[model samples]
Target: MPKKRRRISAFFKILTVLTVACGVLVAGGYYVIRSVQRVELTPPPPPSGCTLTAAGDTDELEVEQAANAATISGVAFGRDLPPHAVVVAFATVWQESKFRNIEFGDRDSVGLFQQRPSQEWGDPEQLMDPVYSSGEFYDGLVEIAGYEEMPVYEAAQAVQRSADGFAYDQHERRSRTMAAAFTGAEGPAVTCWYDTDEAGEADVEAAQAEMDRVFGTDGALPAAESRTGDPGWAMAAWAVANAERYGLTSVEYGGQRWSAAEGIDGWTEAPGEGGGAAAEDQVVLR
Candidate 1:
């Protein structure tokens, strides 16, 4: 009995030593690989609202900025759509208009989706509205194959018919990153905010009512945002900086062209989000 016990103890000691050695090798290898990789920390060029300041596209930046709440609702709650649907929608907008809906473009472009007036979409004034624009974009996208359920960029290109169709394919990882930054949902969902610029000073009655009709409850947005905004150019700049998220392009928003001028190392303070305390003032379109 003593000899048997001794043999078992010796075997156990050998196993422990091997396990420790293997663990060290794994840890060492992981550290070496990570140290050698020169990874890009950012999401690449057009560093969102922050980078737009460098391009003197402040007006455009505000247009692209997205509201966290509204975007979340759009992705998580919309019917016949899944959370990943939200990611795709987010990626599309992130790549398109950066979530900004506008009434002007380079030539004949207008609105958030940048549907060309008198060509691909409709008249100028109507196309300028975000809800109308997004709804239309959504309407067309649902028509694509597996779109309502497919990944975002794939569905987007099916609708956009863009030459750079693969572009949407690459935005998924980043889109999920942006969505996770706000509301953390399971795969296929994301969180977002509303565009204040497109409907600036415009009554949010319809939008709020739509929220109630669809969501069964308001998503608890700030009321002051719905009121007439006093924040100078921030409204405009927010739109431009975040345009790509929505899929805005030179030809999409009315042939509106984007160029790099110069950037202010520090952004001149513009009226930021949430200054009002009213309960009935905040709303998000689309």
Candidate 2:
């Protein structure tokens, strides 16, 4: 009887050990799963404005001003002006409106270039329109003799006649960087990120309409239905420049992608359907 009791006690001890071990394993597994869930549920970083650092690399902002600057340069490109012309246009606006479509400035100035209605730049309403203002800037720009050979600031001042002629030079380096990026001279160099939750969803129709308003009538843009291929890259760059204003979360071209959630990290190899060289002939904006 004593031996039998000892055997029974040993069995209970083994059972207890097994039960404790199993509970510990179950608890550990639960902790691991919960940890993974917590990580997965964490939200992406919020969106901010576009960026183009002074060093000509890495940058963030609302993309509206950026888009406007791009459009100004785009108009120059459409007119067959060299890249330097675009640089001059961008630098001019960087000094004038900081690329914004403002209604007021020093004196009676208005718009991105701050063209004064009194000075014959245009009516306030016309100057306020980016396309018209950009056209006006370019129109004045082309009239200067050998403006392309002159320094970017000098070229800008020749047209602007600002009180301070040297001011435009201060933005030359940065403007060149932006012009290169937006003009697609530097392949997917311009990248931006935004907070989708705050901005809501993107509107493709609005994007198409806006494109038509700016570059369409001049035959400078691809078909409104197309967003891929070489022409697609141009449209993609424009869309990226306008990302903040349009609630665009992502833009992909040439096997890379930029996400508003990615902030100033800039472009990266696209992931899955979102990144990588676009297999389709259309640019994807979401």
**What are the lDDT scores of the predictions, listed in order?**
0.44, 0.73
TM-score of predicted structure 2 = 0.72
Off by over 4 Å in 1: 1-64, 68-78, 148-151, 180-286
In the range 73-188, model 2's lDDT, one tens digit per residue, is 55654455677888888888888888778999888999999999999988999999988988888889889999989999999999999899999999987777777676666566
- Model 2 lDDT-worst window of ten: 223-232
Across 5-70, the per-residue lDDT of candidate 1 in tens digits comes to 999999999999999999999999999899879675765233333322111112222313444224
Misplaced by over 4 Å in model 2 are: 1-47, 53-56, 60-62, 217-232, 261-265, 270-282
Listed per model in order, the count of residue pairs whose N, CA or C atoms clash below 3 Å is 66, 19
Q: Which one wins on lDDT?
A: 2
lDDT of 2 at 189: 62
